[model samples]
Target: MEQIQEAYDALAIEFAASNPKSKAAYDIATKCLPGGNTRTVLFYEPFPLYTERAEGCHLWDVDGHKYVDLLGEYTAGLYGHSNPVILKAIQEALKRGLSFGSHHADEARLAQLIRDRFSGIELVRFTNSGTEATLMALAAAKIFTDRSKIMVFEGGYHGGGFLFKSGPHPVNVPHQFLMAQYNDTASVDELIAANGEDIAAIIVEPMIGSGGCIPGTPGFLAHLREKATEIGAVLIFDEVMTSRLYSGGGVQSELGITPDLTTLGKYIGGGMSFGAFGGKADIMSTYDPRATSTARKGASVPHAGTFNNNVLTMAAGSAGLENVFSPDVARTLHGRGDDLRNKLNSIAKGTILKVTGCGSIMNIRFIATPPEDIHNVRDLEGQSTLLLDMLHLYMLGQGFYMARRGFIALSLELTATELDGFLEAAQGFLRKYATLVSG
Candidate 1:
C-alpha cells in the first residue's frame, strides 16, 4: 500500500507537470464556476484536462497532448465528437428553424422510432435530459399506482437528483423512498413484505451505471418484475446508459423482463441533450390531455418543457437512428466491448485490478481478490480508491483518456487501431506497476 501511494504521488507530480495549461485553465475558471467545473463527475484532484478539440474518438488537450478518448463523454458521446451524420442533421434543422414554440414532424418521427425500438414503450414523452426523464417517470408511476413510497436500490443512480450511492442524497427529490440491496432478491422481497401497500414503484437500472458499472443478475432483475407485479407496483427500467447495450430494446428485452416504465437518455439523441420516458399505454396516458379513458383520471399530468421537442434533437436523433447507428452497428459495438473487456481482465489476472460492466460501458477496480462476479457496491468494500487514481493518471500520461473514476464508455467512431493502442498502453501500465498491483 505504501508503495502504491508512492507511485501515485510520483504519477500525480508528472501529471501536474504535463498539464500546466489545464491547471492554468482551472485556475482561471475557478473564479466564476465553483470547483472550476460544472459537472461533478468531471472534477478530479490536481485538476482535469481541458481539451482544445476532439474528432472521431480522439481528443487534443490545451497543451497539445493527444489522447484516445475512451471516456465517451460519460456515455453521452456514443456517436463520438463531430459525427458528420449527426452534424449534418443538426445543420439541416438549423437551416429550417430553431424555436418553433410548437409541434413538428420530426417530433413524432423520433417518438415513433423510440416506440418501435423499445418493446416496453407503448407511448413516449421527451425531456431535455435523463434526469428529467427519470423524475417524470417516477411522477407518472406514483400517479398511476396512487401510492406514496418508491423502492430504489443502493448504488442506483437515476440522475443527479436521484442519487443513492450509499443513501438518499440531500439534493434528491423528497419522495418517500424505500431502500433495498441491489442484485439481492430477498432484500427486495423483505421491502415489499413490509411496505407493499404503500409502494408506488420499483425503479432500477438493468445494469447500474455510475455506481461501478455493476450488472444486475438475471434472476434478480426478473424477481423485480415479479415482485412489482405481485405488489401492484410499477416497475421502471432506467436505461439511460444501458440502452446502447442491445440495439434498441435494451437489456430488459435481452433478459426477457419488461418493465412497466422505461427511462432513456444519452446517445439516443445523437450526442445532443435528450431524454424520454415511456411504458404501458395506460400509465403513459396520464399525460394525455385529450384522453377520455379513466387512465387519465380527471386531470392530465402537466409536463411542460420548451426543448422537449426541440427541432435539433429530434432531427439528429432521427438521423442517427434511421441512417447512422443501425441495429447491426449496436451489436458490433457491444461485441467489441465484450472483446475489449475480456482482454483487459486477462491483462489484470494476477493483479488487484478487475473490470466490471455490460457492453460498451465498464468500470475498473483495484480490490485484492475481487469476486468472480461483483453483485453490488458492497461486494467492492475494500477496493483501493488510490490505486484507481494512480491508474487514471498513468493512462493519461500514456495518451489515453478515461474517466478518473475508472469508467470507460466506448464510442461508435473508435477504430480497431485506437482500441489496440489503448490495450498496448494498458499492458505497459501493468508491466510498469507490476509491484504495486500484484496480488
Candidate 2:
C-alpha cells in the first residue's frame, strides 16, 4: 500500500499524542524560542523528539521511548553520548576550572597532538566553533594574497557564516564568492579563469556535509591544489565533519592531495563545540601575537577569541584524539560505515532511492535514477524533499533518529548488530514504501 499524506499525518499525529510531555514543552518553548526550536535542523512537522538522555548509540526521549541513535548528533557525537573517557575528561576539567581566560599549557598539548596527526597542518589555532575557523582561514588567505574574491563550489558548506548552497546565506559574511561545480574540474577551471587574478582562496568541504554527504573526486581536489598554487590563492579544505574519517587526518590523507590550509571541527572536540584551522607555517605565522619585526613593518593579522582554549574543550579534545578515535578505532568505524552505506545502496539499487557518501558519513537521496556521476551540485538537483521526509518520519517511528535530509553517521561505539539493525530498518522502509519509491 502506498502511504498517502493522511497516512503520514496519522503517524506524526500518533507520535505527537504519545509524547504529550514533549509537545507540552514545545508549546511552552514557543513562547520563548522561535517555533520552540533553537537549532533549525532539529525541527520537523508536528514536533521534534525531545531527548531526555543518551548513552552509547541509544537515546531515551522525554516520553521514555528508547531509540537507536543513528544521527550521532549530526556527526559531532563521534564517541557517542556518555563515553566514559570523554565524560571523565569533562568532569575532571570542570573540577579544575572551566576557563582560565588566558593561555594554558593544555592548549599546547592539544596543538601538538593535532600537528602530529594532520600532515597538512603544521600550525593551528583553536576556535569556539568551525564557523570561526573557516572565517579566520579566509581572512588569512585574503591578507596573504591581497585579493578580494573567493572561489567556492556549489553545495559546499564551510560553516554557518560560509554557506553557499542555492546562494550566499543572508547571515554569511559578505564575500565575492565565485561559485563552481563540485567535483568538476572543467567548471572549476572556468571559475578560476574568470576570477583567478582576484581570487584569494578556494574553500571546499571534501564532502559536503550539510548539502549532502557528497565526496569530492581526487582528481578534482588535486586540480584545485595545483591551480590555487599557480594563482597564489590559498586552497582551504573544510574538514569539519569529515575530520573523523581517519582519526585526526581526513580526505587529504586518503586522497594524497594536500590543501594549503585546513579547517576542522565536529567530532574533533569529543562532542563539544570545537574547531581548528592550520596549514604551512608561513601562512599561519601571519597571526603570530609575538612582536615580530613585521609588526613594525605593518604586516600582521591579529586574530583573537576569548574562549579559544577553554580548558574543558582542550582536555576533552585531547583525550578523544589520544584515546577514543585512535587510528585503529577510526579504521573500525570507517569500515562499519562503508558496510552500512553499501547495504543501503544495494537495497535501493534499482529504485530512485540512493545512498551517497564515504567512510562513516552518508546521506539518502531520492531521484528518478542515480546520476551517471554525482560530481557536481547540478547533478544532485531536483531531489524530492517529500519522499525524504516521509522516510525520515517512518524511520523515526521505527525507533531511529536521523536528519530530515536523510543524513546518517556512525560512531566508534556502534556494534555490528546495531549496524545490521540500521540496515534492516532501511530495508524495511524500502519494502513498506516500495510501491511509492519504485520508478
Candidate 2 per-residue lDDT, tens place, 1-439, comes to 2464656777687787788888888899999999998888899888877889888889998998888888888889888988999999999999988878888787898899888877789999999889899999998888878899999988878877888877788888998888888888898888878888999999988888888887887777889999999999999999888887854488887777888899998888888889899998878887887737332346577788888898988989999888878888887788878878888888887778888888899888888746346766677777777788788888878888888889998877788888788788888877877877786
CA lDDT scores, all candidates in order: 0.91, 0.84
**What TM-score, over all chains together, does every model reach?**
0.98, 0.96
TM-score, structure 1 vs. true: 0.98
Candidate 2, superposed: residue stretches over 4 Å from native: 1-4, 293-296
Give Cα distance to truth, residue 205, candidate 2, Å. Answer: 0.9
lDDT at residue 323 of model 2 (Cα atoms): 81
Candidate 1 stretches greater than 4 Å from native: 291-294
Per-residue error (Å), model 1, residue 92: 0.3
Clashing pairs in 1: none
